[model samples]
Target: MPTPWRPFASYNLWLQFAPPIGQERWHCDMKRGFTKARSREPLVATLLATDTTPQRIGLLAQRGVYEFHQDPLMLYRSDAVTKVAEILQLNQESAVVQERVISILKNYYSNPILFGKNIIKLSRGDEGFPEPILIEQGNYQFNLFAAIDCIFKEQDGTLHILDFKTGQTDFDRRQAYVYLLAASFLYPTQPAVASFYNLENQKWSDPITATASHLNAFQIEMARISQQHQKDLQRYRHSPSEFKRIFPPNPGINCQYCPFNSICSFSELEVSA
Candidate 1:
């Protein structure tokens, strides 16, 4: 059986490990999706789509009591917000979601102390760093698929790779490390640090530093695991008996959210008594 190719470096791919690999394929192929009357896409897209900086400086006077200059286009951002609402399929839009997104943006933007230059020219935007940096090596191709939310410099000139989250974060460090790894490659000469900002939880993770040797090892591991998954998938597809031998229905933590739970014998779905 010819194995389909998938780059191993992605954080998403590792989340699914079906004893083997073909079980996930079977689950996806057999599962169904339904439409809902109200979708949250509008709120999410609106939050994602607008640039909050312009609004903060131009409209909200978020600089507190300090004499501050506003962005010329602050009022114009509301149009951008509404446009995003249209893109997300919310005809009327939700006031609550809009307020939440704006609040997060204002909070993040106002904290110039945390985001601003303290003692050094570390704010890379202030430090003159490039946007949308790209890095590709071996079978791992990373070209803005997973974006670094923000990249800047610390007072000590440590390059920082930041990821911002709007929801509760319960351990997604692997993704943060991947961002750090990419940043390391992008800035070969500079020391790089990685961290996560959970906006909803109002928490910032302790920044981590990455070594080239460690990043290279992770790259090797990703390639190995990805190729192994493909190989396991081939083995599982050989025959139903062999498939069962390799990819047995053994469900545990992943079962509750598994799309294939309905068809999976080991998922422990309750019988109609």
Candidate 2:
């Protein structure tokens, strides 16, 4: 029989392992534990099942873009935004979700950045999980998962990987790095660059390119994180009661926004007071 599935690494797992620069105070390892370790627990499962407002809007906005490109004439139609809204069933969503998603649809319709491009891949954002890239360095091996949003070839033949954003979240350069690393493996001979575009505000990030050394460094970090996360899972299995010690919590004003806040005793004790 094939060996057991290898550990996995992704930009999301990297975020959970450590906070982005200037945002360390809001980092909570326990949230990672709740998400990756205790995800099967009923309460945690329920919370994970529900999409937060930001998540819902992002998904709908991405779907809206996909809908527009799905039909060549949809973009030119006078009721383009309304048709995408109907396709997205925005009427069923909450008022806030409806309003923001509609705005995003309008923004994309007005701009239509990807309107005419040498497109490679485009995701609707609801596709569960992407296929994993098996990576092996020496005896250390793990799966690297990169869910790229869109990929198109530039006029110069360089592969351009674009990630879409919604809301006020700043573009994390690390995410762009991960995309470039993934591209290096997926299209070894092709030069590639990554960037971010905010659909809500129409902000576009500068194209981010990485050197061979930078890609190697990212791979090393990804491998380390994969092994460490596997060790964490094993530790949790051995002593479930020591979960707090295994994954410490830093409860603060941000706890109100944590999905696990309702069940996290630390957040309940610290933030509620």
Candidate 3:
């Protein structure tokens, strides 16, 4: 089997060839850890994931977020509704938190602008996609995976790819474009547009159309990055014991969020306020 490299949906720092042997070692070591045991979710992450379960409104609702507003009650008494509570470690405020979460969903999904699309595919996390899209350039092959929030069609048959964002983190357009890149090939017959919608800020980004010219440019860039990653990967594979000198650690604020922060030698940043 060909080793599958992660698709470049987000321009993650670790995905690129980080300078110095230390940072590269850190990146490779973290990936090695991922192949071993799946780490348990930290309490902080569990708390955040539980609180944000309503982001699934896009997948569960008939008309994405709009239908969620119309029938939020329908989602009550469901696994989707209770999974968060179950992960909360039986806190005394579980009931209150559940109610508040429901209210937050109601407020966000109530926007009328979210309606009027004929949506067929809905996904959250890794649930909505099928086999990965293979992006091959010469000897480089990247398996592109996109778990799009919602895939809907307008009256005129234009497909819209939606990505739901709950937090205020700054992001680039690469995410939507990657989604579009995979989707364009997934539904080859249809024209697709991808955009991001922030639930907390209630801000919708301008749609980025997926066209031959646009995707061609993106393909060249992706192929280039994949080739670089391929080279980096070869170094580690050829001299596994020499990874210390090949890939180095570059740690800062981001290390605080990494699961391996405790294990990494350079992890020093604080994650909280």
Candidate 4:
């Protein structure tokens, strides 16, 4: 008996690299949009797998800064460009606080001691950072990309992946699972540990062990979501106007904080009205 040909095997090969000539010609018609769509899938998968400590801390800080605009009680501290310009013109005392915040951010990047072990030195002398690995299992392909904040290797060969968080928030279990999934793919039999160091609170959470079952489930979900997103992109290509109509208007809330709000008619009306 002859071996059967699998359609998915060919499809997976095409997906890993470039499309075939016929598919490429079809893609060329939607090249610009398709490029963005293709880039977004892997980016999302990377985020899922390795958006570890530094990213979480940065995201929390950004959210806190953006919250100043959305909350009325915090509006006086809004750091929006227009408000900053007005404060500068008035020679406000708050400018000093702004400068201090900027200084803190600068020092955070420049001073290694302040961050302590939380800062994973990716570059060692002339040696480069470890390259991210892209792995395919079943229907899903995701990148295992993590810049370890700190790695503790046991004499027995147990590997601990320590992540540092600058925010006061607790460790996100979902994120830890994603890291575990990536680690398992890389080191199938090795024990993996995940930890979070919250700088704001000056605390380190207990390390969490990731099980194989959890990782398998997450991988399945990722594949399904990626496929759905691809389908959504195809539908959007068929009717862009229909896709635009699906989402609701932002109203006025997003205007004051949005960087590009000045050029938007809805924003202009909301701000000036």
Candidate 5:
């Protein structure tokens, strides 16, 4: 009646397992263990449910953009930012969130990047999980998830997959590759390119395209990550006490910002002092 469960892979999972270029210093495998492996546990579940400030800002900013496009005329209004803030209830958020989100709304109002484009899809950012693209490569099968923010058609009839970002995180080309891979399956006939746009600074990345060989290589990589992650999870389940070993911790200054720092045994949040 229903399809059987399968391992999953996504840009987020890839980032968790392997940090982006130059960001390896802050990558912590144990954080992924707590997030994906032990997430069902009461304590970990509670911690995971909490939305950090950055997460909140990103969500609200995306909603703001969604609201603006909902009523195109609203974008032309002088009080466009104010109206979007009310819809987002930005006032209820912390001062920091309110300030940043309001600025993002203002930025979008002034520029409105997608204003006249043929936008086919625009996400509200709270749409939970997207339907996965089932990928079967030889004996390995897994679900590939790519939560694309927006997809619009270019004048040349190319499908453009645009991802919205916030804060200071650099654009990781791997994410664009994942989207391209997903697009290959979802819109096989259409030529596609992917790029990133930072809502806060209004920065745009160059459009990224891939060859058949590139997509094939990425599929292989995703298969490897999916299999490796499942094995790690299975190992953890058999021996819960071996979490640290299964997902080794890299503790240091970065632990201060980790959501699981308070509960992480290997956290360097405190010293002998």
Candidate 6:
């Protein structure tokens, strides 16, 4: 018997039995633009096309939002509970996970009081945050999108924006810088102070001062990451199944939380043990 001629033979040789790796790169190669009509991409068309009349586009939109956010609380409201349960095969009604999700939602909903006495009112509207400013610097476009969990405005017109994080993880300086970049793009003239409220720790962190120089550096890093992601997505789309097989699994502790774990051979094997 002769050996088979497989296009990905060389790559598969090294990762024959390894688990799937990397983010799912679905429909990445389609030209950039939002489609009012249904997507023409083969994978997208296959998934979204249905026999139902008038089609459930709103449901599809909600699913898209849930996918990007990956928040279990949001998924529950979006009717993704059954789909998630099928994929992960985990009982969502489990006391531990349910309690954790409830606690997170409570914190998110109580953003204003979470900041304690440091809360400041920025805008007259219920939005709470100051009006966003649009700043354009060189080829970069920055649109500052922030909903103030808490805000404080001074007599001097200096505005402070506070964001709450329910998770125990501390905010990275890089994330602050990205916000600064967006703020600078929106308000070219105003000096803004950005702060993080850690609900779990019950502490308010020192604010990061936004400057033009800092925003420029953040913009460059953002562009680089965006380009790299696009490249990775393109490569994955060329052959998804083959690409998934070739790459060794980059399993994190979070993989256990994934909904698709039941169908995943690697995950099933781990569970059997």
Candidate achieving the largest TM-score: 5
- Tens digits of per-residue lDDT for model 4 on 30-88? 22232333335564445334434344335433333333223344333334433433423
Candidate 2: residue pairs that collide: none
lDDT of each model, Cα atoms only?
A: 0.47, 0.92, 0.55, 0.45, 0.94, 0.42
lDDT of 1 by residue, 1-273 (tens): 953433333444443342233344334211111001111346433443453433322222222201111233433354543433343333333565456554554454444334333322122111222343344556454332344546667777788776555644354666766666666667778887787766444678888766778887766655565565556555545643454445455445545544445445566445321
Q: Could you tell which candidate, 5 or 6, scores higher by lDDT?
A: 5
lDDT of 3 by residue, 75-155 (tens): 443443343333332244446444544444554545534555576665534343456677765665676666676788878
Candidate 4 or 3, higher TM-score = 3
Candidate 2: residue 67 lDDT (0-100) = 92
Give me the runs in candidate 3 sitting further than 4 Å from their true place: 1-103, 112-114, 126-129, 136-142, 269-273
Candidate 2 scores a C-alpha RMSD against the true structure in Å of 1.6
Score candidate 4 by lDDT.
Answer: 0.45
Could you tell me which 10 consecutive residues in candidate 1 have the lowest summed lDDT?
A: 29-38
Which lDDT tens digits does candidate 5 get at residues 1-273? 987799999999999999999988999999999999999989999999999999999899888889999996998899888999999988899999999998898899889999999999999999999998999988999999999999999999999999999999999999999999999999999999999999988999999999999999999999999999999999999999999999999998889889999899888988621
Best by lDDT: 5
Better of 1 and 3 by TM-score: 3
Q: Given candidate 6, what's the lDDT at residue 236?
A: 57
**Cα misplacement distance, residue 47 of candidate 5 (Å):** 0.9
User: Least lDDT summed over 10 consecutive residues: which range in candidate 2?
Assistant: 264-273
